[model samples]
Target: MNPVIVIGVLSGLVFLLLVSGTSFKPFQFLGQGVIKILIGALFLFFLNAFGGQVGLHVPINLVTASIAGLLGIPGVAGLAVIQMVILV
Candidate 1:
C-alpha cells in the first residue's frame, strides 16, 4: 500500500460518492445539515444585524447549532421566543 496509491484511491472513492446520488443517504443528509447549520448561524448573527433595531442576537454556539441542525427553522424561532421570554 504505497502512500500515493492510498491517496489516489481515497480521492477516487470520494469523487465517486460525490458523483453518485442515493449511494449513502445518511451521509448526504449529514453533510447538508452541517452546511445548513453554519448558514443558519450566520443568518442568526444578522438577524439583529442593525445596531439597535430589530436585532435578535442568538448566541451562536454548540447548543444553538445543534438546535438549528435538528429542528431547522422552527428551532430558530423557538430560540428567539425563548430568548425574549427568559433572557430578556
Candidate 2:
C-alpha cells in the first residue's frame, strides 16, 4: 500500500472518531451526521477531481483535522472513504 494513501485514510478515520465523540450528543443528530457525511464525500470527490489544477495539495492530516474540527465525525468518515478509494 502507498504510504501517503495509508496515512491519509488512517488519519481521516481517527479524525472522524475523535470528532464524533465531541461534536454531538450521539443518536440525536443522526440525520445531521448523515448529511455531514454526504457533504464530506462530495468535498473529497471534487478535491480528487481537481486537486492539482486547483493547487489544493491539502495534506491528509490537515484536511481530516479541519473537517473533524468543523464538521465532526461523519464528515471525517466520508473523507476517509474517499481517501481510501483514491489510495486503492
Candidate 3:
C-alpha cells in the first residue's frame, strides 16, 4: 500500500521486537505482537468510520505507516488480517 503505511508497519514490528527483546517470556512476546495487530485493526476501523467526514480518509495508510514504523512487516501483515476481518 502507501509508503507511510508500509513504514508504519515496519516501525511497529521493530518496536515490538525491541520491546519484547527484554522480556524473557515467550507468551508475553506473542501477546505483545497480538496487541500491536489489534491496535492496528482498531485504528483502521476508526479511520474508516470517520476518516471521510473528518478528512482522515487516509487512515489505513496512516495506520500502516504507524504500525510499520513501529512494528515492521509482521505487524503490517497482522494489520492487513485485521482489516480483512473487518471487511469480510
Candidate 4:
C-alpha cells in the first residue's frame, strides 16, 4: 500500500470517529474528578493561607483533596473540625 493512501485512510477513520458521537462517560467522569480534585486543592490552599492566622492548617493530599472535592465545603469544614478536635 502507498504511504499516502495509508495516511488518508487513517485520517478518514479519525474524522469519522470524531463525528460518531461516541459515548465517553468514563472519560467525562475521570475528567470531572480531576477537576474536582484540583478545585479541592485550591480550596485547601486558600484555607491554609487564611486559616494560618487562626492556627488552622489542613494538609492537602490525595485523600483530603478527594474528600473536599467529593463532599465540597462541608468536607473541608469537617476536616478542620477534626483537626481542631484532635490537636486541641
Candidate 5:
C-alpha cells in the first residue's frame, strides 16, 4: 500500500469525524489506553535496564504491559514479585 494513499484515507477520516461533531468518548478512551500501554512498555524497559544489576527482569508483552498500564507502579511491583517467586 502506498503511504500517500494511507495518509489521504486517514486524513479523510479525521475530516469526516471532525465535521460530524460526534461524541469522541470512545476515541478518547482508546487513545488513553494506547498511551497507558506505551507508558507500561517504558516502565518495563527501565525496570529491565536498572534492575538488571539486581538480576530482576520482567518480560514486556501484551499481558505484562496491560497489567502495568492498568495497575501502574503497584502492578510493576507485582510482576517483579511474581518473577522473583518463579525464579526462586
Candidate 6:
C-alpha cells in the first residue's frame, strides 16, 4: 500500500483508458465545442471583415466563441445587441 505505487498505478490506468478511447466521451463533447468555436469565430471574422466600414464587428475571444458555439446565430445577435447598447 505504498503511496508511490498507488499513484503510479492510478496514472497507468488513466493513461491506458485514454489511449484506448474509453475516456473519450467527455472529450468528444469538448472537441465538438471546439469545432463550433472555430466556426463561430470564423463567422464573426467574416462579418467584421466584410462590414468593418459600417462599424459591424464583434470581439473575437474565448468567451465570445464559447457563447456562439453554444448558442449559434442567436449568440451572435445577442452580442451585437449588447455591443450596440454599450456603444450607444
- The number of the candidate with the highest lDDT is 5
- How do the residues 1-88 of candidate 6 rate in per-residue lDDT, one tens digit apiece? 9999999999999999878796678899888888999988976787678668878778899998878767888888887788777865
* TM-score of predicted structure 3: 0.37
Relative to the true structure, candidate 6 reaches a TM of 0.67
The lDDT ranking, best first, is 5, 4, 6, 1, 3, 2
- List all candidate RMSDs to the true structure: 8.1, 21.0, 19.2, 5.1, 9.7, 8.1
Error (Å) of candidate 2 at residue 54 is 7.5
Question: What TM-score would every model get versus the actual structure?
Answer: 0.54, 0.32, 0.37, 0.73, 0.72, 0.67
- State each candidate's clash count: 2, 0, 28, 0, 0, 0
Write the residue-wise lDDT of candidate 3 on 23-66 in tens digits: 75888877787677667666666655754574433345555755
Worst 10 residues of 5 by lDDT: 19-28
Compared with the true structure, model 4 gives a TM-score of 0.73
Global lDDT of each candidate: 0.76, 0.62, 0.65, 0.90, 0.91, 0.83
RMSD of 5: 9.7
TM-score of 2: 0.32
* Candidate 5 Cα errors over 4 Å, as ranges: 1-21
lDDT of 4 by residue, 1-88 (tens): 8999999999999988876645676788899999999999988898899999999999999999999888999988998998899867
Query: Candidates 5 and 6: which is better by TM-score?
Result: 5
Candidate 6 residue pairs that clash: none
Alpha-carbon shift of residue 38 in model 1 (angstroms): 1.1
Would you list the clashing residue pairs of candidate 1? 48-55, 48-56
Better of 3 and 6 by TM-score: 6
